[model samples]
Target chain A: DAGVTQSPTHLIKTRGQHVTLRCSPISGHKSVSWYQQVLGQGPQFIFQYYEKEERGRGNFPDRFSARQFPNYSSELNVNALLLGDSALYLCASSLAPGQGAYNYGYTFGSGTRLTVV
Target chain B: DQQVKQNSPSLSVQEGRISILNCDYTNSMFDYFLWYKKYPAEGPTFLISISSIKDKNEDGRFTVFLNKSAKHLSLHIVPSQPGDSAVYFCAEGGATNKLIFGTGTLLAVQP
Candidate 1:
């Protein structure tokens, strides 16, 4: 089966602009999560959606938001982007939440590299 | 307040030698710990994970050891290969199922 896939592969935006990143989970997966990875740092959690509900959210600013569709795909939106928003946005998918997904580990997409100048 | 930290920015090991990467976390609520490997332009790949209840978990050449008391975890790769050279991140998962990740450690295996 194909793994998680992210769109645009890369993007360039200006400060105060808005951008949307998309992700398609693996087949049969119902949980999707988003993360941001700054240069030289590990990926940080942003939002997690299970079965189209917001299950978890990270410490990101209000400018960041995400939603999952019935089909299990997800979209991450950033409003009024800042230069610090420049990072790789990664989307991960799992079979379920909590223990059901813990053992299997999450499959991540190549990520969308967003650059805000 | 970084909850997770990988103090070592990078590590270099000779091929066939063992490579050990360490991680430390401050959150006691974390119940699951995982390791991920990432290439230059790709997303992190799930490596292996261990429950807080277990001290060690192994798969193929990769083994993860957790010290709950010390709030530390380590990933060991035996007979490291050149392909193993990449940035490795350790993460902690809690009730929310969201993972808090470390700063990452780059491992360069030389042939």
Candidate 2:
């Protein structure tokens, strides 16, 4: 089976500009979550959507937002990006939420590397 | 404070030896712990996980041991292979389903 897929493997954006990162979950997966990984650091959760409903959010600012489509794909939008926003954005897909949300662990995409100049 | 921490920035081990990566968390509320492996320029891939209720969980050459009393966990890879060289991250799943990750430890398995 195909794993989660993300688009624009690499991107360059100027500070203050906005960017949109996209993700397509594996077949039959209904939950999509986003994480931001800065250099020399671990990934930090951003948002999670299950069945098009917001399930969880992280400590990110309002500048970071995400939404899920009916097809279970997801988009992460970052507004007024700052230099600190430069990082790899990862997307993970799962079957659903609850006890078994990560029974097999999350299937992650290769991730989109965003560089803010 | 970092909820999850991997104090060792890097570790080197000989092939066929056992590789152990340690993680510690400050949050006792975390109910699930997981280990992920990542190659350069790639997202994390889940390796093994153990629930708070269990002390140990093993799969193939991978095993995860959790110590709730110390809020610590470790991932063990037996007979480590050079292909296992990568960064390993420890994560904790909270009640809200949020996964907090550790900074990561770069493991280098020598042939």
Candidate 3:
């Protein structure tokens, strides 16, 4: 089966602009999560959706939001982007949520690289 | 404050040698710990994970050891190959289901 797939492999935006990143989870997966990775740093959690409900959220600002569709696809939106928002946005998918999926580990997409100038 | 940290920014090892990468986490509540490998321009790939209840977990050439008292974890790759060269990240998962990650450590395996 195909793994998690993210759209618009790359993007360039300006400060104050808005951008949307998309992700399609693996077939039969119902949980999707988003993370941001700055250069030289590991990925930081942003949001997690399970069964189309918001299960958890990270410390990101209100400018960041995400939602999962019935099909388990997800979209991450950033409003009023800042230069600090420039990073790779990753999407991960798993069979379940929370500790239930810990053993198998979440499968991640290649990520969308966003640049805000 | 960084809940998870990888103090070593990089590590270099000769092929066929063992490569060890360390990680420290401040949150004892974290129930699950995971290791991920990332190549340039790609998202992190799930490597192996260990439950807080377990002290060690191994798969193929990769082995992870957890020290609950020290709040430390290490990933060991035996007979390291050049393909193993990449940035490795340690992440902690808890009730929140979100992963708290450490600053990555770049491992370069020389042939």
Candidate 4:
């Protein structure tokens, strides 16, 4: 079985540009979540979608938004990107939403390394 | 403010020795704690986890101890092997279902 997969393993964008990162969840999984990991720091949750609905959101600003597809895939979009937006964007998938899925631990993709200059 | 913290940036241990990594969290609402291991260019993998209701949880060579009073948790690997070397992160989960993580600690097991 394939694990969660992310696209464009690497990307580069200029300040004020927009960026989109994509992710495909594992088979049979209905939850997709996005996270940001800066160099030398742990990942911070951005958004989580369950069954194509926004289930949870982190402290990220309006520039960050995400949507889940009918097939359970997801896309993370950052508008007017800033230099500070450079980081590894990770996508994770789980069986469902809520504590049960969280307790099961999320399966993560290799992540998209986004560099904004 | 960092809700989760791993004060030690790195740890080195001899093969076959025990390795311990510590984590501290400030949020009392955190109900579940987890550990993750990552290699370069890869996402973090799920490791062992423990609930706030339990003081200790073990799986094979790994054991996690949680001290609720101190809001501290520790991961112990016995008879560590070189393959165990990697960056380990501690994460806390609350009602939001989102995880807050600590700055990872790089562990190096020398042969």
DockQ of 2: 0.75
> TM-score for chain A of every candidate model?
0.96, 0.95, 0.95, 0.95
Worst 10 residues of 3 chain B by lDDT: B92-101
Candidate 2 per-residue C-alpha lDDT over A8-114 given as tens digits, one digit per residue, 9 for 90 to 100: 99999999999999999999999999999999999999998999999998889999989999899999999999999999999998888643644778888999999
Local distance difference test scores for all models: 0.92, 0.91, 0.92, 0.92
The window of 10 residues in a row where model 2 chain A has the poorest summed lDDT is A96-105
lDDT of 4 by residue, B2-99 (tens): 49999999999999999999999898877789899999999999889998889999999999999999989999999999999999999998678788
* Model 1 segments more than 4 A misplaced: none
Q: Residue B75 CA error for candidate 1 (Å)?
A: 0.8
Off by over 4 Å in 4: A99-103
What lDDT does candidate 3 reach at residue B99? Answer: 88
- The B-chain TM-score of model 3 reads 0.98
Index of the highest-DockQ prediction? 3
* lDDT-superior candidate, 2 or 4: 4
Every candidate's fraction of true contacts kept comes to: 0.82, 0.73, 0.85, 0.73
DockQ of each: 0.82, 0.75, 0.84, 0.75
RMSD (Å) of each candidate, 1 decimal: 1.2, 1.3, 1.2, 1.3
lDDT of candidate 4 over A3-64, digit per residue (tens): 99999999999999999999999999999999999999999999999999999998999999
TM-score for all models, in order of appearance: 0.96, 0.96, 0.97, 0.96
